[model samples]
Target: MFKKPVNDWKTSSPLRSSDRKKLRLKIASSYSIDTAEADVLVPEGILSVKFKSYLNEPGVAYLAPDGDRDPLWFSLGKGSDAQREDALLIPTIYTLWKMPKLLPSLSTPKAVIPIISGGADLMIPGVIHCPPSLNEGQLVSICKYERVDIDGAPTPMLSVPLAVGRMAVGSDQLQDSSQEKGKAVLVLHTWKDHLWELGSKKDVPPSEPIKTEDGAEENEDNTNSKAEEEVEDKSNSEMPANLEPVLPEVKTPTYTPDEVSQLLHMSLVQAITQSLSSLPASAFPIPATIFYTNHILPNRPHFPELVLHPSSPHEPPTADSPSTDSPSPDPSSITIKTSSHKSLTAFLKHAEKSGLISTKAPQKHSTQTDMLVTAVNAAHRDVETHHSFATIGEIEAKAARKAAREEDEKKQRAAANLEIDVQELWKPHLDSVELFEAMGESISKQYTAQEVRSLLNSYFATHQLVNPHDQAYIALDQALTACVIPKPKSKKKSPAEEAPLDQAKVEFMKRDELLKKVLNSMQNWYQVKNGDMGDEVALKKGKLAPIQVVMKMRQGRKASTLITGFEPFNIVAEDLSEDLRKLCAGATSIAPIPGKPANSGMEVLVQGKQSKSVVNYLVGKGVPEKWIEVQDATKGKKK
Candidate 1:
């Protein structure tokens, strides 16, 4: 009853080119349902061929480190139009393979991919189009081919289609080129091991079979099938709430303090490997272990193995720690032992020579202050440098004038030169320039010429006798001294004060008078369609202004208590209740809130006594009693 299935299907691996050609023939035969002619795998007509410049190509991919789990190269693609901007284009199958415990579908817009350069990790946006037939644990092959005109050699001109597939077992290579047939010249050169295993019936990992040879059909199935697969995977792939992503583990380096500090400054993981090459055998090799465990591990919350040590170097020394001892008989200085010392005796000897573990007794605070004063006096020096306090020619002219005056007085003294050093005078100018630069342009604009001169003068004066540290404090003090506070002055009063207006003195427009008369005259009023006025309008007959209608309507209701559920204009004649109809019929004038459905004739009153039942009802409905205002018009008071 068992019949052999057709062996006409192509099963060539990408690594083999000769087998690929043979496989192509088989693919062509098996693809067609029609059995009339030799159905060979043939290429559809090549569309426009695009050549991507090596430096300008959108996608730039590199290889990952060897030890990384599921080592994959990362590729970044630039936007087609935006210059120098790159983004990740994550393949559906490759993303799912990289994260096998989860399912990926069209809905997943983002993915994490391995970046080969420096073993970096990249977060990329997912592609909307799902891949066909490829499943988890597969390598993604990116293939493009192009023809080359090498040394006037003419190669075979054959039509070939460009194609790429996810690998089930090993790494896949990617090639980029600029040609149609050349693009398909992806010469794969390996045998399909799966076909050989089919006959033996051994255990094989679950894999989705390739659907068809026609790429178009495969593309169509990719969308719907991925959705279904994702739904199916949801239940099976569920992990604990605390489960997190794991980062690849790396080796630690043996680092000395200088080396460790240098590596910390560099932020290079390879620095650990380099550091280990120079470390002495006695010191533990643990820079990568400590640095990564302390800083890197925390950054990767999903990677728990990164947590290695809990204690910092500043913690208490251990049992075998070196002894704490005094240094040699140096009268003036003290020294301490360095952590790098080999042994206790060695550390003590070095500390003694360096005056760290000193033999001299500690000085009292008053004695220390006296020693500092002596040091300051010894450091002072008197040296005069020439300055352009006045220009060279000006100094010469002033000297000549002084000489003539002194000769006229009949007293000839030695001629004193007033020439100042240009460099010394310009020091203040240079300092001013630095100050102006530091304050930035906006602040510099607010300074007046006098203030600028004062600042410059203070800057130069401090430098003449003091060091930079003391000069800063002097400059600050000078600025504070220069600041002036203005005193407040009393305001002058006018001779006459305007009096507040009384009711009779208040001015009224014609419309205002009409409004008062209209309200006093109205017996009943209600909203009606303007279209139904029929020339005998109520407002016209009463000689009432629109403003009066609005004012009286406001008087009939608390401004905030208008009917809210429906628009006033939408309330037709049929909506009027019997009580409202009677109220309107009894009065010749009425006023109702313009936006409410209530009838209006005389004043309507709302009263509240705060009964326990009423309070409970308001509370049940989540209403605040403070928001409800009750007014008793009869009593002329608000409650």
Candidate 2:
């Protein structure tokens, strides 16, 4: 369930002393540990974070103890009802690492680690060892297989727990031997998941061989020996007598250009036949880049490798062995450069000649290098006759990607609709002291431009400065002239260029011009309020600084994007980080801006160079386009 990052996360105050004691007692009772031990494990002053796991199930809380950024425990069904008794507390990988023996453990082969991490349950057939004392619904940890040197001989031992969950069936069912096809444990959390990513993101610690009672070790060795014998027997029964024994060393087969071209052709046919329906009509005339990224690459087939057999020289080589070291490559990431075509454009051109797809010509003024794919000929003979190479996992992955894209679009639309109120106000300068006094108001107060205009008009009416001939023009009096017009600079002038003092006539200005002059003479400021209930934040002196998105290359050549200057917009850093994690499908964190006060806002750091996505998200949140600055330091860096 935690395979994806937790959503809607917000930190609350630290738990109270009374509540902390109750929580400790509950933990001790659930894990069958002493109260003192539980107290030592979970100390006081731990922080609580609230989040929503599922959209329908709205109450989930994460507990992060002191000195740790990653949460150690999480509780489900923890809602507003304080007296609710059904809440379930589960330990995270961080907690399990500190106390490896907290729960009974089951051993699984290393081959299934990735599958289990991808959110699959622990199947019975994959389990190599299980404790006989485990009961249904009891909490259990799943450990990986480790080879240990026991008395100079390699012996397999169960490593520390990498995942934690509940037993799916009792030990009686597991020991029956016939029950070899059901689920052994319902996996809830695993290593490298979002929960682990929330922490320091450290690799799994080195395993220490679990110590057992005197005779227990011998019994475990006997069980493993029997299991190995059974596997050997099954393999020997399946092998033909004429075949040579398999070798330990394995090699990835190299493909010739012609074979790669054939694979590319097959992949194109498969995409046109099976994946074209998933694209909407609105997406027609798709660019070559989009077609390659979203369609062709995902449907590409893996090139099978050949196993060597010296005795069967005339016969075809067998398929590659399904060993842990050489796992099947993901077909979604296959590149066209390996094929003879060398690029997507060339491959699509080849397909066009084969009557599989049609391309739209670029316009005369267009800058694009490649033409768009306008249509796919699904009714063509090759498309209809070709066998599909897409697997169930690939199809499901495509659907998931489509769904995630749609959800992100929905969030962007919602953010764009959010209302932001920005008000521009003017504060009176010291030079306007006499003017404010004449208008019967305090010079220390700030006023909106419209309010200042109204005051000026009222003062003009009282002083009768409006021109009798034309109301659009205002006759400037002594105070208005002193405040709006600047003093003349002293300069030597020739007699012919100088104007006589008595010849200076009365200065007259348009009311609109006078208003502009009045506003320019005062201090400019603005306040921003997001939505109706959001607090209004004001900048008293100058314009608000733009939100900055900077991407810097880290030590391993990975890019990390940092965002700052969100305080003026009244955005919470923690909330924004959570949203970005979901949008980018990567880990995110918030830290206090360096050299800034603790009470000041924080800066959000994400794991990748997602400057474009961050900019769009800010704009959708009502930040104007001109108020954002993006800098990418990785632009010219070589991978």
Candidate 3:
């Protein structure tokens, strides 16, 4: 279910001792493992996290006993309900690697492993071997047969499980192998899926070598031979034509230093002629780092053998191939250092001599020392005649992938910028309490203007207060009059100057004007709501506080920007701090705002004077400009 990266992930408090114990029992019972094993799998001090799959259905609760980074088990339910026995606890790939025998395994052909990893259900015909006692609906591990050398003899051994799923049908149904045609196992988690990406991302552990007595190896070899014979006999009749054993990977080609230099020169020519030729005149004088990374690197030719199979032998000193004894050098790492030239400066000097490019030295005041690529000599002999080793389709595909990645990143940033809408509302004062009560609402509760008008209309209908002479007016009663009229300010006066008290005025008011006066007489409040699911509308007394961004001078010339008021907007302090660190390229910290309640909110402190940057960032994140107040103490005081 976790095919794509999870977006709505939330970490909850560590599980209680009682809850942890209950979860342990549930896992043991559900997986039919020993209580002791379950204890190790899920120990005390376990933290729980909730995350939704790409489908954004009901979220799954992940238990991370080891730490937040290594979530071992996931249960399909709310975080609080994880302790239940029916939580459907599923072990992650990391957990499966630790305890390979945690579940019964079904052996499939080596060719089928990739298909299964791609999220396809294992067909009955693909199963090379199955445990006789396997039952339907039981969780199982899928494994592939690997040819491991044992005592100088090649023996097909079962590799570590690469996937986990439940059996679609029991072994009894598969007795007539030819008759079994449907899916064998319903795959759940796979090796390189999103769930696996959540962990340490370590490679699958190698299968342990079988150790035996002096003559045991021979007997074991014989048993493997007989098993292979049986598999061959069955495959001959039922196996699909396309299903074949995985072949050994071909070795990558190596090159001498001179050859490497030539390749680098050709790549540079291709980069200049094809990649940089289209740059406009305004884009001249690009930084060497950007030119190399964005243009030169992508235009370089890729070794198909090395790209397709990373584990291929890097040895065997063929005249053209790479040495097998050493690992292949990373294509991206093929810089001037690896070429005949000692450095980028020398490489660029040689290119300048060849009349293929122009370069400029760094300015004296610039922070960086790298030279700039001033212009490309597109009409030079080398640039005009260079033939690109990388195909047109490959270049186009790479460009497409880069564009897609950039678009996805933009989408992610937009998603992270949570926009909260805090609406202003009003609560009735004691003088207007009777009116709200008559309309069936608590006097202390807040209401929007529309809601207040609705309530007033209901009250007017019940009281039959609509003016008969003019439909636009409303006849005011004692309760309505008290709520819709402001009390005149009492002025201190001398005895002789005091005037006779005036009787209560206006018995009627325009409906709109009466509503306006009622709202004015009530206390001000605010209601906040965001886009996140299951969040309650937050109501508070007084006006909604704006996010405060203040730049304060610290320890002489150094300055720090402190921001507060994120709680109401549902922004996490730690997340914002991390984003600021990346955006501003400076250190950031989060601390509880001083003088405020522990739960009020957190303050994000970023190094240096970043008040303006912080304000712009919040505005980009959908916070209204008026909702952010920036104060700069570093600025000089007015004369």
Candidate 4:
């Protein structure tokens, strides 16, 4: 029995305390031979011997128990002499009963060896006294007692060297010295011979006799010839093996005239003629039809059988189709037959063209394995666009683009239909001031600079007005008048004329008067339409400008309709009389005291001034104080 190497738990480790504990437990649980018994010689004053023997046959050897069981008998050898003692011997005592290998030594001062007689228990000299500290694998000689010599010279004690074990031995009989020694020697010799045979035979083959030196050269030649014969035999044993034989640069299969004739079973001239005629005109030979029904054909049983046709000068073999009794071909089956030596080379061009076979097919492939991977995502967009996973801005842009496209398409369709008046579709609102205001807002909201220009172009084109200035003015009026932006119509001209015509128009009209006129007209139109105020005071040359129109507003007002005007100071004073009463409105009153600085009286105050005379005096840097207060009191006569 073999013992697995034990891990010494006493060694230091990097493991944690718990892990080390578990490891120690596992090591402690690991197995080693625990109970082996052997007779070992201990150096002592009196000779001590121990032997284990069986009544049935003492000459038989035994093996120690696998673990903790008793030793059992095993036949090691036979003995010849009766005078010599023999006993069953355990071989692995050296491994199993070895000391210092986890087995505690027996503590009894005197060892007891058991005895047996007639297959029953008996007592004999017990264990041989041995030193307790012997290491494993150390050999020691033990003594065994035989019957006392006639003269009482203790019959030459049996001496046998033994390896210690973990078990102890007890026997009923003593072993004879000479017989045990001879038997031990025989066993050792037999085991050695067995080991030698095993080592020599490892991977070795059957032996052959060596040739003598005198015949060495001939033998070498013969060996070479024999090797060649062996190779030839090996080649011939397999199909297609002997077909292409090469010996370095020299090859065997090349044809001579005689070989060619022999192969074709015809004269050389005839064979050559047949070979030449069979070839096609093309440098590359016409591909032969290689395809056959997958299954053997039944109509001609043996139809594809290989045969040498008499008509062929070379007697080339053909696979004859099988003949059968059936009339209609079986749908589920097909067979192929082929010649042995010649190859079938089908062009397969039609098959490739028809897609039955791939044109550049791989030698071996699988459609499922070569399948294309499909995207998990499927989304549709216009032909000119791609699907997008849009952010907020991208979504807005896409929507804008789509709207623009739709508008263009609509304009195109409208132009395609010759209309009486495309603008008729959009009736300008004659009422609703609020709607007019909204229209401007919507235009600002929707149209970018480019789009505004495009709208203007289309509007002018639809109205058949070519002067861009006039066209733009009219378009602006129409938009404001309409109260909303009506879709613009598409324009067309000869491609060459369009570019220069577009250029002639002012690209921007930042201060155009026509635009302002249009805005005013639109405002009046909207004011009437909404019924907000049909009587809005239109500023005349002498009339005061409307105050509401002049004031600033929180919301931006379009400057288009707002006209700037200049008024005389008198008119301004008349208009602002109420507001002038408030000092915050930049108005003040003054009076004159007698012989003092001038104060307000009948001093003739002009527009926004305290008094006209006072103003005149200020301009002249002098004023009469008496006149500042008294102005034409009874013509300044009675007083």
Candidate 5:
């Protein structure tokens, strides 16, 4: 809209059927088109037409629709009014005043309708409703209050759109009503403007003149005193002569179809380069919150450059402003500029789309959005591929990623197949029957890992081995003291002589220390292979392993008991998180515990000290008690 030169789209390359299809896709993406109207967009009757650009200069525009309905402008390219070839250029006043269906419309209040029609840029406070997706730099059509006939039937002809313009600030900026600040839309064109006159060449029926406009209206019976009074009252209330409306501050879209990716990537490059160049050398692997707070907020450049528009285009010459007496501004439309936070967010979305960065929560099972959206070399490596929207580089990159993933999977499978050495534990009941006293019936059998852990917990709870003041600390009884404290240095050394004579320490073990004591009590057994049953022949030693339940403390000091060995039991994480969120009053993380070996399977992390609660929860959900091991995460040593 300024003094900058432009190229006419009419003079650019001619479009074919395929170009039309691409245009349709861009339209759907740009405007939030619904299913019904999507069917009307096609290429058969498509044609090129000329419309006045935002600067009152002539430029070619595309109309995509069948001959049956009004042909709406779908796309524009190479406009002499803009810097780029693929600009989403529609002035705040021009395109909308002629046909509103060309883009998504936001309705203005009845009182402000005619005023904006006369060409004032919209203020944020005036708008009653705006879609969340509409942000700064987005072009929107302005719709006036609907008109109704005597029978209360909606008047379609009068329902024509009032103006078109770009959003100045996003919806968030308009949250406060008292401020009465910030431009919402920049009107590019309006009804009766030069651009509207040029495009009125089509065979459109004119709106019937209302009887109030010219009294009597060439109809005798319709004329009445009541009608005249109603018209007079309406005119006085709605149309104030001195209250002339002017074009408010607004900018038009410079984004063309092909330029979306290019421009988006350009902004990202600018932001990334700016962000990284100024970053401290030691600030790599930075948390996104800190990165955004420290660098992105203050250093990142203001993106999506703005344009200006005069506040009162229709007003006569004044001391503070110039005259707009002509049909079109001779010099150009008035444009204003401002910085934006919304544009930065848009750039982030673009970066996400191009795989320039990735999001990962900072801590496991954490609700906070302290994510890490770190940039990588792959971003710069793939810039060449973004030139074409549907490029082979993208497809090849996807294929390569898939292949690499398959290679990892193959390696994992090979590793899983290879035999491994393991140690087995068999804690007999006779020697540690005091600890196994809680086992009651099952105390006769050799204890597997789960059984051993369960029996030790039972003994600790039954014998009150834990400090009454603090459950996290255990007061080791004689049964546990022998296992937790080291054995005598020599076989001849008595246990009493070697042990610290000071019972003054109260002989305590922390929760983790008690777990180690329990593990020490179990005896390691051999699962040999390829040998005779007797001692006559040598046997090959094999792996010793059993199902285990483990617990770990996450952020917030919340201890989550993890139930592993669910794979052989066919339990899934999703099914667990789904049902447990209700019972726990919080959403539980049911994804596979990260940083584990491949195919380690998933684990459910219920919130709180949930070892017993989870066991009960699983039992209630019909899980067998034998397969479940409630890893006392509260008692485990730090990993």
Candidate 6:
């Protein structure tokens, strides 16, 4: 369920005061929550309740917001903490968030962080370490991977007990990989989720440093003044994936383009988002150059001499050193390369014009890219934010929403009406090799282009032939060789001669070209079947199985080889009839098969039983020897 608004939860009513007193009395009698932890939740014996819910029966919660918009705690536990999971003393929850000394801790593997945060049931596969005494339904605080700081210090970046969940299984079972596939935790409260949004939207308090084994407080600090000094200043507190714990808001220093690309490697969209997200408070509507140099360049990937001219390190008039000067302005500096934000800025403006993105327009000359771009709304909103990119948050979320939107559009279109395809797409014939696998050898059938494409898709999945890095690419396996586009023999040149462009020409990566390769890989089966230009008509290469010609006995016991199947060979029944008349001494007739539609099939009927002669005539007519199957009526069997 979506979280209730803060106004609905925030109250200092006398009834709530009485409720807190009663809840505190109940916790003291039942659970192990000491006075300090309970006081943090219900401070000064007053409940400045931010969220209250009796959604879960027999156990309700009163959430107190931290200096940051996040919950302190309340009641609700089940089964066992020191007892059965149910039967609670304020839920058996504990946290290492800000108060490491106040809660039980469990260190999960690196991969499990996003999984639990996204609200999926935490599975055992990603859990590397947990408390030995941790039992089912026990609430535990989750921390990220361990970190090593300078001066040989060890510390973990702590947030409020962001995730408090009941253990799905005992720690011992969690370690058993064979039995570790099921849920490991049922998370109750997580930081940045709906619950947190409804509470204290304040700055994260400075973390309490952890002590090292060497008896030193490696990174702890008691910064926040306790008792009524918990309110924190508001800031855009997004943790960009570039750095570990997001660096607090500051006037981000200007960086060269090379630096920015290193952090954000995907696209211009991500570049802009990371830039605006890391800005100092109230710095919005800044000039494009300031935004680009400070945000984009710093996060972008870098190259040597990206910040200054390559030769700028050595002054031209230096007393002791000779200097080289060049007129080329390329790569002079990030500022020059980005054309004073024109290059990167144009990319965004173009994206906006094309409807590929949505953002507030930059101030003209005042904007023409240099215009002020102020962000009024933060990334958390669904409304078009001022991130300078299309969407908010990380690349994964952007991709997910795009996929969902596309799917919805497809469903809507399908519901509206089926429109005729108007792109005028090209459809090509498959070669002999493709036909063998798709339609099979020695078979007479016609397949449409769509059918062939479906066959190609099936072949790819069944054989597991996909590029490991890019799913869109179909990696050609040995099985695909016969149905894949062949490489053109390169012309031998001088030993010293080389051209990178020539090499690039041979690699096909475009989707349409790759699909074309599927079609081009095939040699026209019809061309191979009929001798249109010469005496020799080709057959499927490496075809061990021959075409079949079988003679079946009629009701009167006379045998004849049906000639209807030769249509796939481009041979007409009329032609076969004429051929039969000559081969059978003018006793051949075109006879139709019953039980089928009119003109369903016609066979060459010879007056006397002569399956062998008919088969020999076909073999002599250029059909492969192995391709003919002679059905001997004498034995009433086909060979």
Model 5 ranges off by over 4 Å: 1-14, 32-39, 49-58, 64-71, 74-86, 89-104, 131-133, 146-160, 200-639
How many clashes would you count in candidate 6?
41
Q: Estimate each model's TM-score.
A: 0.14, 0.36, 0.37, 0.11, 0.26, 0.28
Q: Model 4, 1-639: lDDT tens per residue? A: 111111221221133444333323332333222111111111012111122222222232222222222222122224511112342223322322222223222111001111110111111112222234434322222222122343753221222222222222211112221211111110121111221121212111221121122343233343333333433343222211111111111111123333322222211112122232343435222211211111011111221112112222233343344222111121111111111212111223332332222223323555332212111111112211321221222333566698579767875665444221100011112432443354343421222233334544554455554545543344334433343332224466576766664455433333244333233333221000112223452221212222111111213431111101112111232333333334223333222322535431111122222233322322232111221222222223221
Instruction: Name the top TM-score candidate.
Output: 3
What's the lDDT of the predicted structure labeled candidate 5? 0.48
Clashing pairs in 3: 253-321, 253-322, 254-321, 254-322, 314-323, 314-324, 315-323, 315-324, 315-325, 316-324
Question: In candidate 4, residue 570 scores what lDDT?
Answer: 17
Please, what are the lDDT tens digits per residue for candidate 6 over residues 1-639?
113222244443222555566555555444444332344445443333333343532223344432332344454434322123344543312223434434455544334455566666555544433556678877676654433354775444434444667788887776564562467677765555565565544334444332222222222222111100121121111111111111112121243454433223223344545555566657656565554444444433232222233333333333233222322222213332333323556644544454433446554555264544454222433223422322222343555697579767875665334321111122333444543455343324434446656766776676666666777777655445444545444657653454553354432243455566665554333323333334454333221223445566777676555554554444567887787788787566776755657755555567666667776766555554555666665576656
Q: Write the per-residue lDDT of candidate 2 for residues 519-578, one digit (tens) a residue.
A: 888877877776655464655564557788889888968889999998777778888999
Report the Cα RMSD per candidate.
Answer: 35.8, 24.8, 19.6, 47.8, 25.6, 28.0
Q: For model 5, how does the per-residue alpha-carbon lDDT over 119-189 read when each residue is reduced to its tens digit?
A: 56776545543555568877777665324465675331224556667778765565444445557788655
Off by over 4 Å in 4: 1-477, 481-511, 518-639
Candidate 6 lDDT for residue 71: 41
Model 6 ranges with Cα > 4 A deviation: 1-12, 15-19, 29-37, 48-59, 63-70, 75-98, 146-160, 203-639
The Cα local distance difference test for each model comes to 0.25, 0.70, 0.70, 0.25, 0.48, 0.46
Task: Return whichever of 5 and 6 wins on lDDT.
Answer: 5
- Encode model 3's per-residue lDDT on 1-639: one tens digit a residue: 666677788866688888788888888777766454576688667777777777765555555654336767876545436655455788877778767768777777566676677667777666655667678888898887656777997755677888888889887665553444677788888888888877756657776433332454455455345444444555232334223222222222345455556666777778877768888989989877667656665565665223223333332333366443433444533455456775667777777788878999998999979989899888888887775575333665886798579767876766655565778999988677877877778887778999999998988888999997887899989888777666556566654544343354778899999998888888988876664633677677876788888888888688999999866666778889998998889999988888988787788999998877887788776677778888877785311
Error of 2 at 531 (Å): 43
